[model samples]
Structures are given as structure tokens and as C-alpha cells.
Target: MKGNRHPKADIEAALKRAERAGLKVTRDQNGHRWGFVICCSCNREKLVWSTPASAGMEARRIDEFTRKHSNCA
Candidate 1:
């Protein structure tokens, strides 16, 4: 059997993609992970947060949202 696979790898990849898309991921003083995406053209910022278990999801969501709202490549 191949055993069970871990979603950590996929989550990490998503985080990396978010960074490449200009989303900054960070953990706040409250220990919550947050993704901040800022649009230079319109000066609009999108911030999303998630617990440790779903930080990756937040990153992916922020990236997608940022791309749509901002002119990020």
C-alpha cells in the first residue's frame, strides 16, 4: 500500500503560489495566520485570516481574490 498522503505538501504549494501572486502571509500577535493582498493600481487591500488548520486555504482564497481585484500577475 502507498499509505496515506499528507495534505501539508499541497497546502504549502498553495501558500507559495499565493506569495508569487503578491499575497503576504503572516501570523499576527494573536497567533492567527493572515494573508494580505494589496492592489497598487486601485489601492485596495484584501485581508483574510484562518486558523493553523486552514491557513493554506486562506492563502489560496486571498490569492484568487487579489488577482481578480488587483492587477497582479
Candidate 2:
């Protein structure tokens, strides 16, 4: 995670992309800053933790995750 002044906005963008991809973003019980991205199509999920990094890094991470889990294993 790079230094990001506006991490939340970037995170929101990533979440939107995931939503468009048929994934759902949910806050995880691990903590307030932790979340889970679930692939509705395959029932696959990934856990993510937000940091004080740039939105670009967060978005990229999300893109990578979605790409990897786009299909069921």
C-alpha cells in the first residue's frame, strides 16, 4: 500500500468495480478496517485490510483479486 491521502475514495472506487463484477463487499468482523470481497458467481471470497495507502494501490489490489477469482475453482 502506497501513501494515500484519500484511501477511502479509492477504496470506494474499487468496491464499485467489484460490484460491477458481481462481487459484494462487506465489512468483516475482524475489525472496523477489515473487509471481505465475495464473488457471487462462485461463492469465493477474499479478505482485505485497509491501510493508509494510496487509492491506486487499493484499487489495483482489488482489480487483481477480482481477476483471480472471476471464475469458480
Candidate 3:
């Protein structure tokens, strides 16, 4: 029941972390349950779900994405 619910603050914190890592973060146009993380240099983008279950893992995912695309033009 409660396992599927995510705390709003955790999701917000993850988005903030994404921004601090130099990624442009935007909430989905349709709702807050989804977000977009964009690479400022290459214009590459990734869709991230906003949820407490995934919040703690977002940083690592962002790091990997950045590293993989670091050489993009």
C-alpha cells in the first residue's frame, strides 16, 4: 500500500542534485511524476521518473550518462 508512494521532498532533492551536476532538469509538461535531464553541451536528454524509489539512484545514473556523453559534440 504505502510502498508505492514516494515522498515529494526526495524527488525534489534528486532534481536539485541533477541540476547541481550541471544537467538541465525539467518536470514533465503533463505532470510532476516525470522529469527530463538534458546535457547542456550535446543537447542529449534522458527521461527520469520522479519517485522516492528511484531518487537515491538518480545521481549514479546521471554520472554514467554524463561520462558516456562527455565527448559528444
Candidate 4:
């Protein structure tokens, strides 16, 4: 959440990683532009987010799915 690029990508990258690891992504009843949840085998990693979370949160969320969980720091 500190670069010129959208930080939401970070979250999306995280989601992608989660999915690749056998996780699932789900949007709320509100039809996105809101937040999502990352579900693991055990439960959910719970990556709750909000738009303007750091600028372009939507795109950021998508990109975040590609990142590794450990890389989340």
C-alpha cells in the first residue's frame, strides 16, 4: 500500500496464490467493487478488503491472487 501502482493488486495476487494452492475465491452478495474471501482446505484465509483500500483496490485484488501467502508482508 505504498507504491504508485495499485496496491489492491497485492490482495488479488494473494487470492491467485491461494487458489493455486487449492483455495477458493468468493464475492459477497453486493456484486464485487466490495470485497472477497479466500477459502483454504481447512477454512478461509479471510482476505477481507475494501475499495480504496490503497488505490485501485479492485485490480489490486485480482493481482494479489497471484502472490504467495508468505510474500504478504
Candidate that scores best on TM-score: 2
> CA shift at 53, candidate 2, in angstroms?
3.7
Q: Clashing residue pairs in candidate 1, if any?
A: none
Badly placed stretches (over 4 Å) of model 2 are 1-7, 52-54, 71-73
Tens-place lDDT per residue, model 1, 5-70, is 222554446555655766554433223434344555556665544345565675466657656754
Residue-level lDDT tens digits of model 2 in 1-73? 2332224777767777777777878765444355778987777776666653566776788888887776545
lDDT of 4 by residue, 1-73 (tens): 2322223565556555555655556654242334454544334345444454364554454445534342432
Residue 35, model 4: lDDT of 42
List residue ranges in candidate 4 displaced over 4 A.
Answer: 1-7, 29-33, 38-40, 45-47, 52-73
With candidate 4 superimposed using the best TM-score fit, by how many Å does residue 20's alpha carbon deviate from the native?
A: 0.5
Full ranking by TM-score? 2, 3, 1, 4
Candidate 1: deviation at residue 65, Å?
1.7
| Window of ten residues with lowest summed lDDT in model 4 | 1-10
Q: State how far residue 34 of model 4 sits from its true place (Å).
A: 3.5
Segments in model 1 whose C-alpha atoms lie over 4 Å from true places:
1-19, 22-35, 50-53, 70-73
lDDT values of the candidates? Answer: 0.51, 0.68, 0.61, 0.47
Residue-level error in angstroms, candidate 4, position 27 = 1.1
Per lDDT, the best of the predicted structures is 2
